[model samples]
Target: MYVIHLRYTGALAEIDDALEAHRLYLGRQFDAGAFIIAGPKVPRDGGIILAASMDRDRLDAIIAEDPFSQQRLAHYDIIEFKATRLAPDLNLPQSPWL
Candidate 1:
């Protein structure tokens, strides 16, 4: 799977405006099964992580439609990951590697 890290770097005002659209987009992804988990940073400064499709091209296309990207409210860095291990108690229907 891949993790997209989105960090806000511009004015909070712009981020606020984009937040709603961003949330909606994320909801769509969830409904479409393209998004597994997503949320903001705990400290409110680290950014957000979106764990979903591993295809960078597909992920990039989705991010291109994000409000943050469209409005230039934030910058994003994507990282590809391979699931080498998972907690023994962890339970998920799909492979953690996606």
Candidate 2:
């Protein structure tokens, strides 16, 4: 699993300009089952993406397609974790094993 943390580095206008494109990119990833969840941060400074079922290389490549990344509007921190547990009601594309 991966937790993609994005921090805005550019102006708000720029981020707003690319928001649609970024959302579209995310939509594509969702369709492909790469992203489990995504949304803006509460402070509106950036965003978070919960991703699964992919290797680092591939995930990085896919992330590069985000408008924020391509236009240098944000920086990404991709964290990998071995998920050992999940709420019983939650289901994800990747297997969360012990």
Candidate 3:
């Protein structure tokens, strides 16, 4: 599993300008099964994304295409980890986590 954290580095105006394009990119990634969940942080300074792991290089390249990234409006922190627990309601395979 992987978690992507984004911290805005540019002005709010700039971030807003790219929000739509960023959402579109997110939609595409969701459709392609690259992402599981994503949302803004509580303080709204940045955002978080939960996703399936792919080749690190590919993941980096894919993220680099985000409007925020393209405009140099944010910094991305990608963290990869092995999950060892999940709730039954999630209905996901336990093999990887276990």
Score each candidate by Cα lDDT: 0.73, 0.88, 0.85
Order of quality (TM-score): 2, 3, 1
Query: For each candidate, what TM-score against the reference?
Result: 0.81, 0.92, 0.90
Candidate whose TM-score is highest: 2
- As for candidate 1, its clashing pairs are none
Instruction: Please write out the lDDT profile of model 3 over residues 1-98, one tens digit for every residue.
Output: 68999999998899999999999999987777777789999998999998776777877877988999999999999999877888878854322222
lDDT of 1 by residue, 2-77 (tens): 6778778878777777788889988987776677778888766436655654567777887888888887877888
lDDT of 2 by residue, 6-95 (tens): 999998999999999999999998888888999999899999999885667888898889889999999998889978999999876753
Taking every candidate in turn, the Cα RMSD to the unseen true structure, in Å, is: 2.6, 2.7, 3.2
Ranking by lDDT: 2, 3, 1
lDDT of 2 at 81: 90
Choose the strongest candidate by lDDT. 2
What are the runs in model 1 whose C-alpha is more than 4 Å off? 93-98
lDDT winner between 1 and 2, please give it.
Answer: 2
